[model samples]
Target: NQFKAMMDSANKYNVKVIVDVLPNHTAIDHTAVLPALDEAVGGHDKLYHANGFTPIKDYNDRYQCTTGEMGGLPDVNTENPDFQHYYMTYVNDLLSLGVRGFRYDTAKHIGLPSDPLDSLAARNNFWDVATGREEVKGLRLAVPADSLFIYGEVLQDKNVKESEYAEYMDLTASAYGHALRTVLDKADFNADSLLNWHHPVDGKHLVTWVESHDTYANEHESAGLTDEQIRMGWVFLTARQNGTPLFFSRPAGSTRENYWGNNRVGARGNDEFKHPEVVAVNKFRRSMSGQPETIATADNGAVIVVSRGNAGAAIINLSSEPRNINGVDTTLPDGDYTDAVYGSSFKVNSGKLSGQLDPLTSYLLYR
Candidate 1:
């Protein structure tokens, strides 16, 4: 009932919900795979890999990576036709309940048809069937393939077929996130340093983030980032015209001093998503969709400017002190503009923008 209510509320707001679907493995004792349940379901031998609970010793070995246990959880035999049908049916059930898309967790652990390291038993057309590119015998989805938003967590690694995965759905741009984080840590706004996406596919087929749940909660790699730093990175990412940018909300009540305040599992996180700068940049992104993006630096590379064609620009000041934008090159048409978030005034004249930005702040200016 709670899930239904959430879906209903999301629909009322015209928001699309993408639920996380673990295609790699389930709990070691997941009810469906238990002895009694497996027997009742006619003992579908291919439901899980024969490797059982054996831990994968070498992740680079494609067979063990795809079939053996990950973190002690039993890996699913994705190559099995019966498992494919059952998983597709499970996805269909979610779609029937108003889920518009899915985030396939540990997608790289699932074998690709082109992976040479896996034996014939480990290869499958699971991606094709899941995305409705190839039809399953009796499986149907409540939502069509064209209407659903799908992305896979195909973390980049040796033998990971990213381009093949892109043929099925968007893949997370983990390298790009790392680059942004590096830039944030160094307070360097070098346009050349941050421009490369480091992906095999185009940006449209990539999901980018300033930080992810794994970066923060699991490894604590991004836990050191303050809310301000994250907001700055987000402004630069969201203002771009390419990849879909995702914002990770920290634990509820979390602060610089208290990293895990109110860290109840499954509870809603902090409200930084509604921050004025974030809201402004999101609006700018939506309003300027399809516009070409240009990156530039001002204030001795302390201020980074991301301009979307002639529509608008996101100017981010990454330094500790205020900076003056004096005749910075821009694509915005000549006109007077005001920051959407803070109402700061800016002017574009003769193909250049000039404005005063506060320390560690961002301005969204649009015509």
Candidate 2:
């Protein structure tokens, strides 16, 4: 009832909800694996892979990665016909409840149809069934597959099948996030170094992020990043014309001094999502859609400017000291403009943009 009410509210506001679906494994105590519910999907024996609880010894081994247990959770036999039907029915249930999209968790661990490491009986058609490419009789999505926003957490690995995953849905651009973090740490905003997504598939088929939950919680890879650093990264990525940018909200009451405030797991994060600069950049992204992007760096790589054709420009200064942006090149037309976020003034003359940025500040200038 609570979830339904939330979905109803989201629908009233025209917001689409993307639920996370775990396709790789299930909790050890999941009710679906119990004897009573297990029978519906060909009993417990057929529901899980034959590997039992064997932890994966080598992730590079595609067979083990797909079939073996991960983090002590039992791997589902996604290739099983009965389980496939049951899973599809589960997905249809979510769709019926107003889940317009799904983010497949541990998607890379799921085997692709072309994976030669697994035998024919072990090869799964889960992607095809979920995406409506291959339909199951009496099991259909409540909404059209094209209308759903599907993406997968296919973290980059030596054996990752990124192109194959892109064929089905958008894949997360993990490498690009790492690259952006490196540039931020070095305080070097080189356009050439920062612009490359480094993904095998086209940028449109990738989901970009500055920092993800995994980066913050699991490995603490991005846990040390200050909110300001994240904001700068968000502005740069969101201003681009390619992949969908995801903004990760940090934990509530958390700060650089206190990493985990309130220590509340699964609770809503801090209010960084509604920061004025973030809101402006999000609006700028939507307004500048379809416009070509041009990137330039100045002030010894302290400041980076992203121009969206003649529509708008995003100026981000990463340095702690105030920097003077002098004669930076941009695609914005020659005109005087005021910052949409900070009210700072800037001028574009003969394709050259000049502006003054306060310490660690950003400017969103639009026509």
Candidate 3:
């Protein structure tokens, strides 16, 4: 009934809802956990770490990463063929229920088939076994082949690599957030750094976000950027040329719990789409989809003009003082234009645009 209601709302809004799943670990009291415990090693491949794999001693050991328990939750042995088929059954059920997309949580913990560190090499890669071409072909027999979309929560740092999972699906560009926070702290939210973020994979294969559920509850890292500053950050994220942008909506007036963190949802708020800038920029993004960016930077990199394939241009100001964005190559016809967000008017002269960008504000200009 809950899923039906959700589907109803999704249909009403003409949107597709993606569900997040924890494929790596399960609760301590899960049904499969107890049964696996009593079964002899290798007797029941459904058990946790059922391959008779020993404990991983080194923190960075590849074997340990794949087989180790994540925080205390019993980790599933994705390498087990029985387990692979078992998990796919659940996925197939969800597919039958009209689930169009999936978000694989903690995907890095699962082992790749034929890992150099694994003592056993026969285990099939979890994704390949569960959702690769063969599995997807079977799924397509039941539904449209292009209907199912999947992305993984493969967070990348110095140790974790995103290229490993590039074959399966897009990955979350976690570094995009960290890098934005860095420049926002320095009071120079330059778009160049973000546009040229050094990631192992190309921008097309990544999903970017300004913040997530976890970041909101943890104040130390993002608290430096105030709510207004955060909104400014959003302009940088959504107005950019590459990668899909995700907008995370947190409860209003919510703070981190002292010990538990943001473990629970706070008071529900409708502030996410209520802001005028967000509304206008979202419309511009839709209109400018698939457009290449022509960047023009000025004011010592404090101001930028992102021209989107001649469809429109986004003029952004990163500093606190209002400055005139002069001689910006918007690539728009020489005519009058209005800022979609602020309603400020400007005239294009000789294929160039000049306007006074308000302090820490953005202007979406369209013909």
TM-score of each: 0.93, 0.95, 0.84
Q: Tens digits of per-residue lDDT for model 1 on 1-367? A: 7888899999999998999998768786655566643553336455576764568898887777777799978876676666666678788878877999889999988777775433425356777778887766677555777788899998787767888888888999998888888878767876436777888899988999999998988768888988888999999999999999989989999987788889998898999999999998988999999899999888767889899988889999987788888899899999999888999999999989999989889999887
Q: Which pairs of residues clash in candidate 1, taking residues 3 or more apart in a chain or in different chains? A: none
The TM-score obtained by model 2 is 0.95
The segments of candidate 1 whose C-alpha lies over 4 angstroms from its true place after superposition are 30-41, 116-123
- Lowest lDDT block of 10, candidate 1: 115-124
lDDT of 2 at 127: 81
What is the per-residue lDDT of model 2 for residues 8-95, given as tens digits with 9 covering 90 to 100?
9999999999999996587876555567548867777677777646788988878888878998898887877677778788888888
**Deviation (Å) of 322 in candidate 2:** 0.3
Every candidate's lDDT: 0.83, 0.84, 0.69
RMSD in Å for all candidates = 2.2, 1.9, 3.9
lDDT of 3 by residue, 97-198 (tens): 677888888877777654433344355467775554555213322444346667788777556646777777788888878887666555564633766656
Give candidate 2's total backbone clashes.
Answer: 0
Q: Which ten residues in a row have the lowest lDDT in candidate 2?
A: 115-124
